[model samples]
Every structure is written in structure tokens, then in C-alpha cells.
Target: MGQGQQEQVATSLAGAVSEEISASLAPVDAELERRYPGDPGTRQPVHTVYVPGDAFAVDTIRSWGEKALTALDTHAPDAASFAAVLGLSDELAEPVHARVRAKLEHEPIEDLRVDFEDGYGPRPDVEEDETAARAARLIAEAYQNGTAAPYMGIRMKCMEAAVRDRGIRTLDVFLTGLMVAGGLPEGLVLTLPKVTYAEQVTAFARLLEAFEKTHGLDSGRLGFEIQIETSQSILATDGTATVARMIQAAEGRATGLHYGTFDYSACLGVSAAYQASDHPAADHAKAIMQVAAAGTGVRVSDGSTNVLPIGPTAKVHDAWRLHYGLTRRALARAYYQGWDMHPGHLPTRYAAVFAFYREGFEQAADRLARYANRAGGDVMDEPATAKALSGYLLRGLDCGALDIGEVARLTGLTRADLEGYAAPRRGDLTASTK
Candidate 1:
């Protein structure tokens, strides 16, 4: 048959089986509905600093941010020193030096995570509950006194068979203690590391539900992040992508999926010395995660660089240079969130972030101005592009890259306009321009 005739015949036949097919596929449709990934959040922190849980204290985290500032002021006090630490060419650094300095001075750490996994490796059983208690007390105190970061959380051990008991016990104790002592704060996330299966995530969700009910909290008050640290998390035995399944299994409590660079690389048999965030295998896995989580409200984060900023001597300029490059690579991939291992990593983190946002500030501002004026000469300023430009400026403003006056001059919008801004309204653009 001719192609058109064949298609017409197929369509006619399809109508005959449509009702039966729909009935037969009802179960499949239900599965798909169950597997739907939820929304991706509007904003995500740029970095999550990991402090070993055993050694965790709110005062210490606060102090680390303070110490990072002092270190920046002491070591990279001037533009020359700042340029040297980040290894920026004098010409490249000259423009952003002031912005970097201001960011370091104001907000050194964007997020902090108290890690109980690798960072707190195999503590004594007795010590675990005490540590959990301490963490709970400090968490409550930070909330009351306003000493915490904008985002903070605790990374429990993996949910695999090996550490499942320890992991759940630690979480239960920490949470029970947190509630009894005072209350959990907003923006708190529980980190479940080394997730290898969807069942584990579903179980964690159940745990969150139980915790909520027991503590008289909201149903989804206790959200958690899953770590994509193993090959199994990226692909299943049947060779299908497991990320979607993992997100489905979270049942709406999964806040983000974090990449554990060293563990993920080691799982792929990458050499210890060569394992890095930009590894091809790591990149592939993160790309899969990005695709799976795209528009699903589940944020995707890149893994950390294993290299520490500490050395035998106190000289850290070289170390900061390395850290900055690593962070820059993550930013290049659009993975704003990553793991921070040391206090020294703080300066380089902000330096790289501000540099990334500042580099495109001028172009974005000009594009947004023209687009907002409803004049897109030689530039395709669709609603999507305008929204992206507004988002860039919003993030820049949040990170202290540009202040209110700079935003007004660049985009011709007041702070309030941008704060509740979604996209350029069709009518607003037409009416104002007309």
C-alpha cells in the first residue's frame, strides 16, 4: 500500500482497538503516573559545605565562615593577593576583584552540611547518639540565635544493608532529640548517601512520614537528599536509567540528588589520583541525573573535588588556586551545588561563583534591557530568554554580585519587580511599549 493509504488504514484499525488497548494499558498508565517526577525547585544553594558530624557544632560552622573571611582578609587582603590565590591573570582579576572581596566579606559560605558518612567514618556506637544529641542541640540553638547558614543539613550513613541499622538509628536519635530539645529549623534536609536502589529511597520516605507523625510535624516536613555515588544509581541491571526510579521512589520528599565524586569515581575504577569532578564517567552520570531531574523539582548537584586546601605548611594560595579551578569546572556544567570539605574551600567557592555570575553580567543586562523594552533587534528575546536573564540577575543579586542600583540601571526594573518576577507579561510588554 502507499504510505498515506497505509497510515489511514492503521488509524482506522487503531480506533477499533482503542478502547481495548486503553483498558489493557490501564496498569501501565498507573505505573507511569506513580513514576512521575515532581517539580524542580526555583532556587538552589551554590555550595554545601560538609562538616564531619562527630565534630559538628553550630558555633564551629559559624566560626568557619568567620575564619574564612579572616583568611581572605589576611591572605588575599588586596586585589593582588586575591588574584594570586585564585590564579587569575592580572587583567582578568582586575575587574572582579572588588566584587569577590565584597562577597567574601559578606557571605563566605552558602550552605553547610554535617556529614556522618565518610567524613565521620565508623564512630563508636555510644558516641553516635551523643553526637546526634549534640547536633540536635546545636541545630536548635542556631535556629533560635540565628547563627545558621541559609541552608543546612545532616548527611546520614548509607541505607545499604551494611549500615542500614546504624543509619536509621542515627537519624531517629538525632530527630527525636532535635524535636524533644526544641524544634528543627526551616530548610533542613537529611542526606542519605550511597543510594543504590529505589526501594531504599521509598523506605527513607516512609521513615520521614513516621517521624512527621510521631513529632506532630507536617507530612513532608522532613525532606532528604539522595547521593548518587555508585554505578547502580546511574543504571540498573536491565540497563535502564535508575535516576527516574529513584526520584519516583522519593514520593515527593527528595530535595536534591548529590554526586559523590571520589566514591562515584572509585566505583567506576578511576584511579584515586586521577578521579575528579570533570571525569567523563562522572560527567555522564551527572548528565543522566540532570536529565532525569529536569523540571521535576528535584535539584541535581555535582560532586566535590577530593583535593583539600590544607597542606603541611600554612601557605594555601596554591591550594586555593586548585580548588577555584575545580569549582569553576562544576559551575561550567551548571551544577551550582557541590560538596565543600574544608574551611579553606569557602573563599575559592565564592570566588568562583561570583566570577561566573559577574563575567556575564554586562551582556545579560544589555540583552534584558532591550528585550524588556520589546525591541529585539538582531536578538531573539523570547519569553524564555527574558525569564533566564531575569533569573541570572536574581541569582547575581542574591550572591551579592550586583546591588539594587546596579540591577535597576541594567534591567530598568525595581527590586520588587524582579523579586516577584516570573516572566515579562504579554500585556505589560505591549501596553508599556505602545
Candidate 2:
């Protein structure tokens, strides 16, 4: 062939190859987008405190937090001192402690889950209804008194076949009581644990829709979170990851996916003594949850450390230390939210979260600020990095760890910009930069 003709043929072949590649990859891209659309823009609480249904009262929860704070103070008078005892450097300790104090003073409980499953198991129907009524009354009262937690909800029993009827009945009674009293609290959520099938999630969503219509409440007002307890929830009968299918089944009401540490480990035949949040089984579940919930905007939380902060008065700090280690591990894994079973878990919960935020504060803030200002000349801030930075600032602000002024100072963005960055936005940080 002539040289010019050879060049022309090569160019045409390259174009054809490119087209073929694009066509081949389109389905894979579509499937990925379908599974993980990204960030649902939900408010994720750092910890869920599951108080028993029969005994849940806003005041009581508040009292428990207060007591935990007092216990913390007794162990370590201030954040710096606490850090010293924990072997944390002052740089890390001071900021976390400051945030901890602020959190305790203002909003200690980010999410309060009045438990009906394991926490308050198998109460008589009348008694359960009464407890539901009492919870509704307390929630209404707290709202009026301005003492309610920022996020509050109930943890209904599992929707598995065995307890499906009882679970729905309790939910009905609870919602009915809540409606009669006043209305559902703002940010109210329902937690359906041990979800093993997608059908269960769809049925529960319908139930919520029906309750809204029956009680004249706003449609889609209620959202739910699911617990990845059993292996069945993660692995379908087809032996493929079912996380995406379960989320799809929620039909847009899935706020979060919580890893049930102990239950998950147990399902793997891990002994009770060996069961823990950091187990491989639990980590696998968390990975499945992260991948499935990613790009979908759903919050993912780790399970709690069962090692309660309880012992002789003199040795109580020992348990606190253990819980702190577990909390730190969960934070390191990027599971910002977890379950808190006891009142005493509060101190470690705040301490670990604050510490995690503090550890990355300087880098995240500086990079984000530079990126926002378009000053990171050689340092490119990718979309993923911006999302992470924005999320860090959002969690700090939402949990009272950082305020508007601090966020602006650190990120070079105003409160409005920070709020906008809490979720996905049309423009980049440069659009919101000062």
C-alpha cells in the first residue's frame, strides 16, 4: 500500500477499536452505576444507643449520658489528661477531648434507638403496646421541651419468617401510638435487623407507606436501616453478593446498612469468645456493605464492641480502655457509625470519633482549603478526595465536633457551602470557594 493509504487505514482501525471497546464496556458501567449510584444524602448518626423499649424515656437516656460523662470526668478530668493516660500525643488528645466535652455539653446522643428485639425481647402484646405509647409520649414531650436527640428512632424485631407477624404488630402499635400522640419525630427511623431477603425489605416499605396513609402523615416520611447479621443477607441463594438487591428492595427508604458484629461472626461459626467487630467475617460483610452502598448515598455503620464498660469502681477504666480500642478500630475502617448497647459506652464513643476526626483534621482541612481556592497548583483534588473532605467536615459539624466558623476557617468555604457539600452538588469546590 502507499504510505498515505497505510496511515489512513491505521487511523480508521484505531477509531474502530475505540468504538468496539466503548460498546463492550457500556454494560459493565451501567451495572456498576445501578449497584452503587452513590451517597443518598442521609443524616448518619455516629452511634445508635439502643435502650430497651419498655424502659425508653428521653430523660432516662439523657441521665445515662450525663452519668457516663461524669464517669469519664472522674477517670480523666480533661481531654489532655485523658490522652496522657491513653498514651495519645497531646496533638491528637487535646482536639478530641475538646470535641468530646463540647459533644457532652450540647448533644451527646446523636441517635437513640429504642430497641424492641434483643434489647426488649418478647414482652406481652399489651405491655409492648403500652411501652410504645410511653415512648411516643416521651418523644412528643422531648420535642416540646427541646431536649430531643438530633436523630431518634426505634429498632423493631427482625422481619424473618419466625417473627414477621409479631414485628409488624409491634410496629403498627408503635406508629399508631406515635400518630395519636402527635406525630413521628423528625429524622425518625426504623431499624429492621437480621434482614435475609429483599422481599422483607419491600414488604416493610409497603407497611410504612400504609401507616402513613392510615395516620394521615406525609408519604415517605419514614426511612429504615438494615442490619447485615446473617450470611444470607450478604450472600444470596445464587452465591452472589445480595447487598445491592437488598438495598434495591428497600425502594429508596434505606438510610443505612449496619454490620451486626456478633451475629455475623456467630453465623461463621466463630465462638462467642472469639466473636468481635474486627473479625474477618464482619470485615467481609462491611466490605460488601461499603461496595453496595457506595455511590448510592446510604450510610454504613459498624457494629458495637460487646465488651461493656462495667466492673468494680476502681477498675471501670479498664473496660473503658478496651472499648476505646475497639471504637478506634471501627473508626479506622471508615465505619463512622456503630451501635452502643450500654450507657457507659458513650464516653469511648465520643472519644474515638473525636480522635479520628482530629487525626486527619490538619491534612484534610489544608488540602480541601487549597483545593477550594484553586491554589493546589500541582496537587489535584480528585472528586473522591473532595467528597471525603466534605464528609469529614459535615460529620464534624453535624456531631458538634466542629462549628460553622471552624469549617469555614479550615475549608475556606462558608456554612452554606459546607452544607451544600454535605451531599453531592452540581459544581465543584472551586464554585463554593471564598
Candidate 3:
């Protein structure tokens, strides 16, 4: 109870804290430099890949959208699915955007997005205050909530010849609506649909860079997500490092690479009747994404599980649904965060996230504190001290158990190890391949 005793305890704890924080940090930096050798920011699988729900739900139309979305939620390959709910034109409904907005605000959407292409209806210029206000309302609602509002994104019409074949134009206006009316919410990641070539991404990024400058937003702050719908993006390019090459083409602007499964399978002449979520084409598409993200900052996400667990079998299918959710680890292995199509996938999303953090942060904290106390420069000894700590750093990363900064702070694992550690080395590859 005495002041002297209290002072000694406080001083002792503070010294311990100092020692702990110091020990792990030094080797963490050295290890990172040894492995990566360059910019850590540019490492593979940059952020988590966020999958939007609109591609699947939009076909059901805004009226039946919710029911369809809930079904996808139940059986999606992973948890935390991204959904695209667009704002309707003034002519369609007075506050047409409200329905879509409600789905995003209410549903378990990971990324809230909209379709802003001209044929998607409404020119950026003609929209009056009411339409703008409705659009703004949705954006504001998402932002104010801790939800990743819009994260601010727009899915522009496809640049692929296939989309043009459908007679869609006025793509330019989509960019304008997002920049001008949507007010370009911060941390915005644009979804460029049906990209057939790397040039499309470069062009779009350039357009965004111009807009960002004009609006006084930081140049290059706006990032991108690629829709792997076109056949060319998947096959035929820079063969081995297809994804890496694709990312290179993005000029470091690509944040995530998503599988447009339905369209992708369709592009390969796979019929909807025969096409299931596990089709070979879909598998190839995801494989490419994983390879591309290797050692990069980009994140790759698996596509949706098409079987909707909606009917009486929903109970029986829950097991399979949970099993399928493990695809999130596959994406995590690639260091990608979001996936396309399937808001129902949110559960798996959180599952992957929680599993990683559960051990990563806590274990990493303990290691760093221990290292700090020793005061010796040799943080890496052997058996108990070095390997045990390194095991946590490596295993935590491989299993999506820890993030880059955490291991980077402690055992000297490079950001690459943290980035590459999404899928820990598995002894049983045969059973684990999703």
C-alpha cells in the first residue's frame, strides 16, 4: 500500500514494457530485409479481396434481390461476401436507390458497390438534386455506419469486346457519377468489370488519377479490382506468372483480383446447366489469381459456391456450406482478402480472419516481450528460443494466423512471409485443395 512499493512496481513494469518492445523489433526488420529486399508495400496479396453480391443478386432484379442474396449468403464459398446494389435512375423510381441501399445496410455485405455505367441508366449530367440526394443518402448511410460504405466503388461497363457486342456504351459517364455525385468516398476501390486486357485497367486508373487530381484527392489513392471474366485475362498471357503479370499491368493500382465465375465459365463455353461452382474453369481462374498474387501485395479471393442452400436441404447443406467456406483459406494463402459474388460468404470471411488473429497477435506479443527483456543482440539462438519464435511467425503467416506487421514486429519475418502465410504449408494437400 505504500508509495515506495507502488513506485517500484510501476517502474519495473515500465522497464519490462520497454525491453519487450525492443527485442522483437530489430530482427523483425532484418528478417524482412533479407527476404523481400525491396519495398514491402508492393508485396503480393496487398489487401483482402472483397467479393460483391450484385453479379449474382442483380439478375434476380432489385425486387427479389434480398431473397437471392440470403441464399448466396448461406452457401457461398466463404463468409463476408461483397454485394453490388445499384442506385436506380430517377425515371425508374422516385428513390429507386433505396432498395439496393437497404440491402447493403441490412445484409451482411462485405463491400457495398453500385453500377454507374450509362446504359446502367442515368447520365451523370442529367441527374437532378432528388436523384443525387438519394444516391448521396445511400453513400452517407454506408460511410457513417462502421460498415465499409461503398468502400466507394463503381462497376463500370465491360471493356471487353463481348460487352460491347451487347451494344452497351456511355462508359465515360460511370466514372463521372462516381467522381462527381458519389463524391469519391475515401479508400475507394473501383471494380472494372469484364476486363479483357491489362490496358483497360491502366486506362481506367489513368482516368481516375485525373479525376482525383481535379477533385484535389490524392493521386493514385483510388485503387482497383479486376473482374476475371474475359477468356484472355485467364489464358494466353505471360503463362507462368499470369497473375503477377496481370498485377504488373495494373501499375501497382490493382488491390484484388476476383473470379467472375459465371461469366468466366461462360467465356470458356461452359453452359450454365453443366456449370457448377467447382468447374475446372473456375478452378483454373482461382489458381491463376493465387499464382499472380504470390509475393505481391494483392489479395486473391475464391468465387462463390453456386448451390443455394435455400430449400429444405438447407439444414443438410449447412455442413457442406461450412466446408466450402474453407476456400477463404485458399484465398488467404494467396494473401487476397475479398471475393466476388455471394454476400452469404461473410461467415467464412470472419472465420478466416478470427482464426489468424486468434494466435497471431497473442503469440507475437508474447515473443516480442520476451525478446525485449534479454538485452542481448542475438535474438535468434536455436531450438527453444529461435525456432519456437520463428515457428509462430512462419506458421502464423502460412495459416493466415498472423499479419505482416505483427510478425514483422517480433521474429524478423519479412512482410512477404506475413503476406505469403495465408495458407500454411499443409501436409495433406490432396484433401485441402479447394
Candidate 4:
């Protein structure tokens, strides 16, 4: 063909074919949008600190911070000493240590749950009722006075037949108390523990819906974390992934799926000595949970270690190493959050989190900057990788692992720009690139 002559384009399909295909799959498109809405782009707390319901007080947050700081002061007095204990790199030692201490002094507990289940055990009806009400009052006041953790609420009993009524009552009293105390706080969180079946999740969602109706609150205003404790929660008798069904049963109100380390291990008959977040059994369960939650709004949290940092200096150091190592391992595996059972665990928790983000800060920022600028680099990153990169930096900033000024300097993107990159659905991100 001559250069000036246009080539004839040939197509067999009708012009309406694309429209017809889209119309045929409209419902599926809607379903995909509804079910896999992607990350909410909210600040996910680094760790959840669970205090027994009866033990929770208005000052619990401050108390935990003080205790953690005291633990740091007594165990590792200086940045170099603390870094030595955790074996942090020479470059990261000073910054990570300083940031960890600053985090403890400022925002020690990110998310807190007043445990009404295993930690509280079985209590008298009236006593339990009073405790639940008190928790609400204290939590309400904490939020009112700006002393509350970023997220706070109760972890009620399971939907099992055994304690179903009690669990319902506690949740009712707590939520009602919050309402009576002047409405729910923005950071309210709830956990439905020991869920073994999807039906239990459905029941919990229904219960929350009823609560919203009763309070005249907006529909779907209440969301809770589903605690996966039983082996049956991971795998049903029918050999399907029960946890996936549970997420669907939540009806878009499931914010997280938290692993219950000890309970899950016990359910699987793992010996106590071998039950841990990094155990093969634990990893398998979490891997399934991660896949189930991926692209969905739900997040997965790792279970806690029972090793408390206490006793002699040497013993505390050993425990710190264990907790720090577990936290770092979890971070690497994309489990951004876990449970901190003891105040003593706080120091090591921040240390591990800060180190993880700091160690990778420059690389992530560079890749994200390159992607944002469309500048070619050694590692070619697509939008999906850009999403991950921006997400990593945002998480680091949220948890105080990296400073805004530094991130801005390196990435040449403001917080808003990072959010723009990180907040979209994965499908949207890739589609836009295409």
C-alpha cells in the first residue's frame, strides 16, 4: 500500500458485540465490585492490645504506655543498648531506637480490645454486665478526652451455643452504653471470636444490623473482626475454605480476620511448645486467610506470642528477641498487624515495625517515585507493584516508621499523592495502566 493510502481494517464481530458482552456480564461486574472493593485506605493499627474486660480502665492506654516505657528504661537504657539487644543494623540502630521510644511515649497502643471471652473467662451474669457497661463508659470517656487508642472496642464471646446469650448481652450492653454515653466513637471496633462456621458470621452480621436499626444509626455502621481459632474455621467438614464463606457471610461488615494463636493451635492438637505464629500450622492457616482477604476490604492479623518480657534482664532480652523476630517475620509475610498480649511486648513491637519499614524505606520510595514519574529504572514496576510500594510507605508513615518529610523528600509525593496511588482497587490500578 502507498504511504498516503489508509489500510483497510477488517473485523468479523459486529460493532454492538462489545456492548452485548458487557450487558451480559453486568451482574458479575457488580458482584466483583461489591465483593472485592480493595483496601479501604484507612490507617490499620500495627497491633491490637487486648486487656481483660475487667482490667480495662479509662487510663489503660496511658498505663500501658508507661509500663512499656518503664520496661524499656529498665531493660535497655539507651539507643545503642536497645539496638544491641535487637541486633539492629548499625545504620538503623539510632533512628529505630529513638522512634520506638517516641512511639511508646506518644502512641503506644494503636488498637485495643477489651477481651470478654477467653481472657475474661466465664463471669457471673451481673458482674459481666457491669464490666461491659463500664468498658463502654470508659472507652467513651477516653475518646471524648482524646486519650483513646486509634481503635478501641470489645472482643465478645463467640456465637457458639454455649455462650451465645452472654456474648449477645455483653455486646448489647457495651454498644448501648456507648450510645447512651453520647454515641459511638469513630474508632470503635468489635471482634467475634472462635468462629467455626459461616453461619456464625451471618448471625453476627445480623446482630449488628439489628443494633444499627435499634439505635437509628446508619445501616452497616458496625463492623467486627472475625477471630479464626478453630481448625474448622479454616477448613469445613465439606472440605471447602470455611473462612472464605465466613467473609461472605459477614455481608461487608467484616473488617478483619484475626488468628487466635493458642486456641487455633490447641484445636489442631499442636503441642504448646511448638505452637507459634511462625509455626507451619500457623503459616498455613494465615496463608489461606490472606488469600481469602486479598482484594477484599478485610485485613488479616497474626496471632500473638505468649512469651512475656519479664523476670531477669537476660530472660527479658530473650523474650524481646522472640517477639521482635516474630513481628519482623509477620511483616515480611504481609501480615501488618498482630496481637500484643502484654504491655512488655510493646517496646519490641514498635522496634520490629520501625526497623522493617526503615530498612526498606528508600527502596520502596525510589520504586514508587520512578513509577509515579514514569521514569524507567533497573526494576520495572507496573501499577500493581506501585500500589504495593505506595502502600508500604503509607503504612510506614501511619505507624511512625518513616517521617512525612523524609518520605516526601524521597518519593516526591505528598501524602495525598500516595493515597491516590494506594487507595484504588487493584483491578482499577491495573486497568488504568493498560
Q: Kindly indicate the candidate among 3 and 4 with the higher lDDT.
A: 4
Quick one: RMSD of model 2? Answer: 5.4
Show pairs that collide, candidate 1.
38-296, 39-296, 39-297, 40-296, 40-297
Instruction: Name the runs in model 4 displaced over 4 angstroms.
Output: 1-12, 425-427, 431-434
Winner of 1 and 2 under lDDT: 2
Highest lDDT scorer = 4
- Candidate lDDT scores, in order, read 0.78, 0.79, 0.49, 0.94
lDDT measured at residue 151 in model 2 versus the true structure, 0 to 100: 79
Q: Rank candidates, lDDT, best first.
A: 4, 2, 1, 3
| TM-score versus the correct structure, for each prediction | 0.84, 0.87, 0.54, 0.97
lDDT-wise, the better of 2 and 3 is: 2
Which model is ahead, 1 or 3, in terms of TM-score? 1
Instruction: Report the Cα lDDT for residue 156, model 1.
Output: 88
Q: Which residue segments of model 3 deviate by more than 4 Å?
A: 1-107, 115-137, 144-150, 161-183, 237-243, 271-280, 313-345, 348-434
- In candidate 4, what are the lDDT values of residues 1-434, reduced to their tens digit? 78999889899998799999999999999999899999999999999999999899878888999999999999999988999999998899899889988998899999999999999999999999999999999999999988889999999988989999999999999999999999999999999999988999999999999999988999999999999999999998989999999999999999999999999999999999998999999999999999999988999999999999999999999999999999999999999999999999999999999999999999999999988898877988877788889999999999999999999999899999999888865466656332
Global fold similarity of model 1 (TM-score):
0.84
Q: Give the alpha carbon lDDT tens digit for every residue of 1-434 in model 3.
A: 76657543334366778778878697985654443232233322212223222232222222233544454444432222221111112332222123323443353343545554322543343442233333444454455554443244455556556454221223344344555554556645566777777777777677667766877877667678787776788766555544555677776677777776677887889988766445777767778777666445565655545544345534425633442354534534443344433333333343444444443455554554454344344343322343234444554454343456755566454644433432323222123211
lDDT of 1: 0.78
TM-score of candidate 4 versus the correct structure, residues matched by position: 0.97
